[model samples]
Target chain A: MRATTIHAPGDIRLSDVPDPALSAPTDAIVKVVAGAICGSDLWPYRGAKAITSGATVGHECVGVVEEIGGEVRDFRPGDFVIVPFVHCDNTCAHCRAGVQSACVNAGHTRSGQGEYAVVTQADGSLVKTRGVPHADLVPSLLTLTDVMATGWHAAVSAGVRPGSTAVVVGDGAVGLCAVIAAARMGAEKVVVLSRHEPRQQLARAFGATHVVADRGDAAISAVEEITDGIGADAVLECVGTAEALTTARRAARPGAIVGYVGAGHGVEMPVRPMFEKNVGLVGGMAPVRRYLPDLLDLVLEGAIDPGRVFDLTLPLDKVAEGYRAMHERRAIKVLLQP
Target chain B: MRATTIHAPGDIRLSDVPDPALSAPTDAIVKVVAGAICGSDLWPYRGAKAITSGATVGHECVGVVEEIGGEVRDFRPGDFVIVPFVHCDNTCAHCRAGVQSACVNAGHTRSGQGEYAVVTQADGSLVKTRGVPHADLVPSLLTLTDVMATGWHAAVSAGVRPGSTAVVVGDGAVGLCAVIAAARMGAEKVVVLSRHEPRQQLARAFGATHVVADRGDAAISAVEEITDGIGADAVLECVGTAEALTTARRAARPGAIVGYVGAGHGVEMPVRPMFEKNVGLVGGMAPVRRYLPDLLDLVLEGAIDPGRVFDLTLPLDKVAEGYRAMHERRAIKVLLQP
Candidate 1:
């Protein structure tokens, strides 16, 4: 099987690896159909976060169950399924509480950009579609495994409600997905902060009512101006950088919530200012497994086209190019066909 | 007029000062009927927070309107009112959004421990009772101006709901009141972290179902034992120290919120651990003005008696003694009669 691996900073390769097999009764073998690069994957590619040499990379995919362990009740071979970034035993207390990402018995998927992947907690983690749908729906279905659901989690964590003025502080795929989430949640206005022209246009098409191409103080000022100098009713922090988080906090109105979904890098939580402003911070890893069911329905019904975020696509052998495209900002997201 | 002033750390004194006068058209002069020393006041008393020598202190009081500025409405001479620590024009965006503490045009009341105090935004900050009630209700009414409302704010921010297992992380007046708030909000089990015997009894009386006396890691373990290792559904971080905040977060179940109200003293926000656990942090200065009406009715109707937090009483002339009692932990709180 060909799988993506990172040898070092700025070095991504598609290496031959042993074929995946069900290691436990709770596991399932998934033949990857479509996998997408995520913003978080860039951490290792850019050396912002360390990785062991030749570590299995990527964690987003839509695939067909090639085989399943005896204990797997809900899924079987030949079924089309979405594999969340993290696999969790859905019966755990955290999972029952809709925080599946924090499930006690959790395992992470790390070889989505491969010919085949072994997923643990198969019965609890995989969400099967009605059938292996048309090829055109594959990309959107793939996003539900991570980015789209993550965006929705941000909206839910921020308490985005009808008539809310929502501010999304990032323009990555997740941020763009968050714009759709906020809009779908009935936010009266969705304000997106993006400096790039392409992402800004996509954000607008995805339901951003206003786009502020400013950074730092100017960005906050722009959000204030759009919100009657009161800041936003709900803020989505999709970029985990300190500056992005700071902007997210400053963009929230008093009593408003900032739902953060980005994996933090060199980020320090601003406690004093948040305390003084009575602003609340919520959200961490999106409970993608928890949201998978609803989001799958939305995607299948054509309610959202989150797949548009995939600006580039390639064969699994070109996984290195995919990583480069995302790391260099040449592509919003790159979809890999196995 | 006699006012309490802090000459230095541990140096509290009753000093003669010019009578408070209406400084703005929205101001109203109040003759103090009851004032209580707060945990926050002890900050300057112990010198944790810098204070100007001889600066007037105290910000919790129930009083009678002595005089009103020409523009003052909803309050008049002879009316008994609860003066929130922070005054705000309720018409502002923040105020209207129920975050009066962050009102754009906000003012702090800093002379509650005085014979008379001037309150700004009279119409918005002063919640007038039907009439001056008997002395029995004075103490509880005074709490509505600060602690009681603050406790409620913590519970509200933490999203305390029916059937929730709530953990209150402090033994102070606000924390005890938070226990009451959690119970009132219908939490099935109210867990209070208090080592003091006196406070533990009071917490139980206020509706705490469990008391964890351990500190640091042990305290967190005890809470886990109580909640079957799942942690509380809601946590009230009423003590603003770093250790207390850490305990609050550790005692919370994944997806639970930690509503903090204690004035932070050298506290650093724990962003990484919080992110990993999906634990949320929210709350700040309580919006007493916004919660005053509902809480006032509860007091007047005998539904709650938050005044019980004041374990000691002192004459106005002995303001120094009140501060000492609170500072030395001889009293959970002290009520001053002017």
Candidate 2:
């Protein structure tokens, strides 16, 4: 079976690899319907993250259950499902606490291994839709597996409440989706910090009340201006860069919460300033399994169209171009049809 | 009017200073009956935080209102009260949200410089006990002004739920009080990290089930071992040191919460590890005004004796010695009687 592999920096390719099979009683084999590149993928693509040669390279997807192991009970063949980026047993103490991202038996599912990927704790990891979604809706539903859940987590963690103001610190798919999440969560004002015109427009479409093509102090001032000089009630750090993290910190009002979902890169938690402002920082990887059902419902009900994040799409064999387009900022997210 | 003042590092003096008068329409002048040296005072005495010569330096006190401004309605002259370290107007949006520590008109109250100290937003910043209590109950009631409230905030922010496990990371008065707070919050197991014999005994008396002498990694391992490798459900960071902060972070289970009330020193937030573990960090200066009523009731009813934090007591003239003892770590907290 053909799978995507990253051999080195700037060297992602679609190559023949062994097809995955259910190796555990709780595992289910998923036939990839649509997969996409995530912001985290850029870490390995840019060589910032250590990667072995010919390593499998994807952790987001929506697919159909093709096979199941003996212990798998909830899902059956041909069922459309959104697989959470992290697999969890769901019954563990942590998973029961709605922190499935930190499930005791949590593991990541990678798509670059083959057409079939084994999802551990299959009963808990996959959320099935009412039926096989239309091909056009597949990309958006696929994102429910990661980016959408992540964006939702960012909003939820930041404590974006009804009639509150929220500032999103990145303009990527996650940030744009955060705008949507904040809106859905009842934030009266959603501001997206984006310099890119296309991304800013998309942000507005997703419910951003304002767009500031600014960074750092300018961004903070912009948010404060919009919030009557009080700063945002919540700030979502969607980018892991130091500047983005600092901006998120400074843009929040005293006692405001900063929800960071970005993988730590250049980000450094500025302790003193955060302490003085009494800002609450809460975040990490998205507990997608905890949010999947609610988000999937929103998608099915047409409340959100996160697939709009995929500005470009291509066949699975053209995964390299998808990676290139994302890396070069030509596409926010690139959907790949298998 | 006589007041205590810090002339420089290691130098404290009590001398006559101008009596404080109402500086704002909402302000009130209070004659302090009791003021205590907090762990934060050591920061300036140790030269970690610079202090201007002859600056008044106490922030925790219980006093008798000597005068009230025209705008003060809820409080009046001759009222015995616990003054929150930070003054806040309770009507502000932040205060309405129960974060009086970050109130729109928040400001600090200085000790040492008067027979009278100005309490800003008198009606909101000072919470009067039901009635003037006997002199013997003064110390415990005074503690509700800051340390007790702070410890309570720490436990509350850490999400100490019934049947949960909680770890208090500090041997200071706040940490000892946190043991009480955790137990009061119904935590099934209360663990305290303390090497000091007195503190450990105090922790045990306050309901800590386990006492560990180690710091950081060792302490975390101890907690994990106690919780069957799952870590504590809640952690309170009561010491504002880098090591204590790290220890609190490490001791919490994935997705558990840490309530930090420490006035940060050189502490650096470990963003990556915290993110990976999905820990939630929340806390800041305690909104004493928010917790005063309940804590005062607990104290008045003899349900808790948080003032036990003050192992030593001295008259106002011996303020220098009190500061010296606390600065040199000879006392956990010192109560100054005027």
Candidate closest to the true structure, highest TM-score: 1
User: For candidate 2, what is the DockQ?
Assistant: 0.63
> Which tens-of-lDDT digit does each residue in B199-229 have in candidate 2?
8888998899999998767777899899998
Question: Where does candidate 2 chain B have its weakest 10-residue lDDT segment?
Answer: B108-117
Q: How many backbone clashes does candidate 2 have?
A: 1
Q: Write the per-residue lDDT of candidate 2 for residues A199-267, one digit (tens) a residue.
A: 999999999999999877777788889998888899998987777888888898878889989888645
Q: Residue B130 in model 2: shift from native, Å?
A: 4.1
Residue pairs clashing, model 1: none
TM-scores of the models, in the given order? 0.98, 0.96
DockQ list for all candidates = 0.66, 0.63
RMSD (CA, Å), candidate 2 to true, equals 1.9
TM-score of candidate 2 restricted to chain B?
A: 0.97
Error of 2 at A217 (Å): 1.7
The parts of candidate 1 lying over 4 Å away from their true place are none
What does the lDDT come to for candidate 1? 0.91
